[model samples]
Target chain A: MEKQQTDKRAAIMQAAMELIAEQGFHGTPTSQIAQRAGIGVGTIYRYFKDKDALIEVIHENVHGTFISTFTESYDPQLPVRENYLRIFSTLTRLFIANPYEIKFIEQFYNSPYGIAKKRADEIECDKPLFAFFGQGIQQQVVKDLPFEILLGLSLGPVLFLVRDHQNGFVNLNDQLIADIVSASWDAVKR
Target chain B: MEKQQTDKRAAIMQAAMELIAEQGFHGTPTSQIAQRAGIGVGTIYRYFKDKDALIEVIHENVHGTFISTFTESYDPQLPVRENYLRIFSTLTRLFIANPYEIKFIEQFYNSPYGIAKKRADEIECDKPLFAFFGQGIQQQVVKDLPFEILLGLSLGPVLFLVRDHQNGFVNLNDQLIADIVSASWDAVKR
Candidate 1:
């Protein structure tokens, strides 16, 4: 019974994400999510107290997925450049697979919703990626710039590439991604 | 008479920008801009047919200021590193002096007003900067990557620095700016 309930809850969350991505948080109604998931509205209520609760769950799930993907593939024992390449490549793949999640996270970060969480929880959630970057600094493989600045240096180009792709300003070919990754590494690696 | 008209137009544009920055486009009214400029509302309408026209004027003025600052100080004859450093320093100073303009531009870029402009006008407005960068690539002084990718690599760190400063996440000291510039240049320059 517990397993069945969990599966139903997962289905509801998945449906909610799709609806939210389609129509935004304010535009999506609980009834629509329930209908889309083939579950009763009461079942969604049992899993999430309200729309806000559902959104939080979705946010946490996306963040968790990003963290786990990095941690699972990251090898602390590897050379710094190779480790960075792994993290970057993994993140690019994850983002490609979950464009909606990327949009959701970016929108949330730019909105007032991002500030209510405890800084500790936020940091803890991001610790894996941060630790990988921190390792680079310790090994003197990256510049001694602040971790966030280094991160922006390494990640911002790809973000722009993604943005350009979305805007139809540029095409996203493997050659472009390779150039971005190489240029990014060349910029920061000591 | 022409000089006096130019002065009045400049005052009106300045007033409109101030109002727009403070209250956003939807929140600001023409009467408030007139009052701020110590001109009658009729005078504003004489120069600008409507609020949208006023916004266009502001956009053009701001773009002009930015382009002039960038090109006037940019020496294409210099080595790539020196030329980049000069332009970066000039831009940093401009951003520091007019942070609100920077914010306004960013907000405007993400708004419908900016979207209504044609791609040709947008490219024409930014052509000087693009030409400088293209020259760097042609001279083999910078990375031989896609122009947009190279641009993102070069400028992405500065955007992060500005964001950190605006959010009070970090201080914008000379040392910090220098380090960021050096690090970013290291990433892209050949």
Candidate 2:
């Protein structure tokens, strides 16, 4: 019974994530999510207090997964550059594998919900990644820029390339990913 | 009479843009747009065929304005590096000046509408910019990567920084803009 309950919750999240990613949040309805999940609307309510709560949980789950993947084998003793590469490449692979999650993240960050959450300080910064950047800057291994700017410089092109890849404009094979990641390093390195 | 008609049309477009930028497309109703414009709901239909048509027209207008601004004083006779700096700085300035339009664009490109347009090749690539990239590659001044990859490397960081600036995470003054643009160039240049 516990297993069944967990499966149903997973089903609800999967359905909601797919719908919200494909359509803007406002475009998707809770009823539609329930329909897509092959469960009753009330079942969704049992799992989540409301649509907002459901979306928030989805965000936490997805973001947590991303953070875990990149930080799994991360070693603080490694060269900052090596640590940076590991984080970037691992995160990129995760994004490539999970296209829908990527789409949902893009939508969430650009939506009013995201804006409000950010303003309220609810969406905490990824501390591990930020700490890595700080250490690199202090070591004079990276540019002397704000953390936000560094984050943008590091991940901006990557996100753009991922979009292009998802759109069928480019195929990000292993070689290309390596090359691009190297170039991204150049963008931030002093 | 014609001048009044133009003003009304402009008013409707302005209202729609603002609402859509704040709320996702499905979240915004045409009636709300009309109310915000201080005009009748019917007035919007008179100017635009429907919401989709209105959105398309807005995309074209915003994109056209961006192209015109960057390409206005563009001199192909200049070095590839110079032209790139000019284009990047100009576009960055425009994005800074028009927060609503930038939000609209970010939302649009990540939405189904933007995806569909891209798939259908309806969203034409900017020719002049492409030509510049091509020229740089041929001259061995830039990395010999795919144009799409080059584009991501060039504009990805800029867009990300713009978002950070909009969210008050960073203040993108002229100096930082110049530095980021230079870093972007570094990512693409040989």
Candidate 3:
């Protein structure tokens, strides 16, 4: 019974994400999420007390999934450059596979919904990404600088590539991705 | 008479930017802009045919100011690292002086305004920024890679810094800015 309930919750969350991505958070109706999930509207209410509750769950799930995927693949034993490469490739694949998640995240961060959750998440998961860079600095593999600055240096190119891809301003390919990864590694690796 | 007209236009643009920064584009009204500029609504009409016309002028002015300021200070004859430092410092100063322009530009790019002007601007001014990087590669002062990739590597940290500053997530200090620029140069210089 517990497993069945969890499945239902996941289904509802997945449906909500798709709807939000298609129509934006403001445009998506709770009824659409319920219908898409093949569940009744009342079932949604059982899982989420209200529309805002559902949206918050969706936001948390998306961020949690991103954090888990990124950290699960992270191997502290690996060389710093290799570790960074793993992160770059993993993120590109994740963003490409879940373009809706990418769009939803970008939209959320630029909206009020994100503001409420950002501080908590930053305290929990986001700081660790910077901490990983600090580890690299300690190991003398990355430049010795403020970890945030190091992060901006390492991740800035990827953001531009992702933004360009999202806007349809440029077409990304394996070779292009490889070139970007190489250039980024060249820039940050001591 | 022409100089007076240009000054009024400038004042109007500055007022519109401040209002948009505070209230968002959708939330702001033309009357508010006129009132802010201390000009009659009719004067705004004389300078701009409509609200959209005014935004376009603002966009053009901001882009023109950024490009001219950067280019005027850029010495193509300098080595790549020095050139990067100069351009980065100039851009940082510009962004610091006109923080509202950064927010306005982000909002503008995410809206229809970006699509309308991006193509034209791509051909005219955007190409030149990339060409400047291409020149660096030719001189062997920059790493050999796709120019866009190199450009991203070079400019990404500065963008993130501006973002953090705008969001009140970080304070902008000369030391932090210098460290970021230096770290970025280390990343890309051959």
Q: Which candidate is the best by DockQ?
A: 2
- lDDT by residue for model 1 (B7-74), tens: 88889888878766655565467888889888998999888888888888788778778878877888
DockQ for every model, please.
Answer: 0.33, 0.74, 0.39
What is the Å distance of residue B92 in model 1 from its true position? 3.2
- Candidate 3, residue A101: the lDDT equals 86
Worst 10 residues of 2 chain B by lDDT: B117-126
Cα lDDT computed for each candidate against the true fold: 0.73, 0.84, 0.75
For candidate 3 chain B, the 10 contiguous residues with the lowest summed lDDT are B107-116
In model 3, which regions exceed 4 Å deviation? Answer: A1-55, B1-12, B29-50
Question: Candidate 3: which pairs clash?
Answer: A187-B187
Q: Write the per-residue lDDT of candidate 3 for residues B1-190, one digit (tens) a residue.
A: 9999998988899999888765556657888999999898889989888898888878877888877887786787877678788888778878877888877776565454465676576457556567777877788887777665666777777887677677666777888788777777766777
Q: What does candidate 1's lDDT look like per residue over A28-88, in tens digits?
A: 6789999999988888888889878888988888888877886788888888898877777
Accuracy of chain B in candidate 1 (TM-score): 0.83
Residue pairs with backbone atoms closer than 3 Å in model 1 (clashes): A187-B187
Give model 3's DockQ, 2 decimals.
0.39
Classify candidate 3 by CAPRI docking class: acceptable
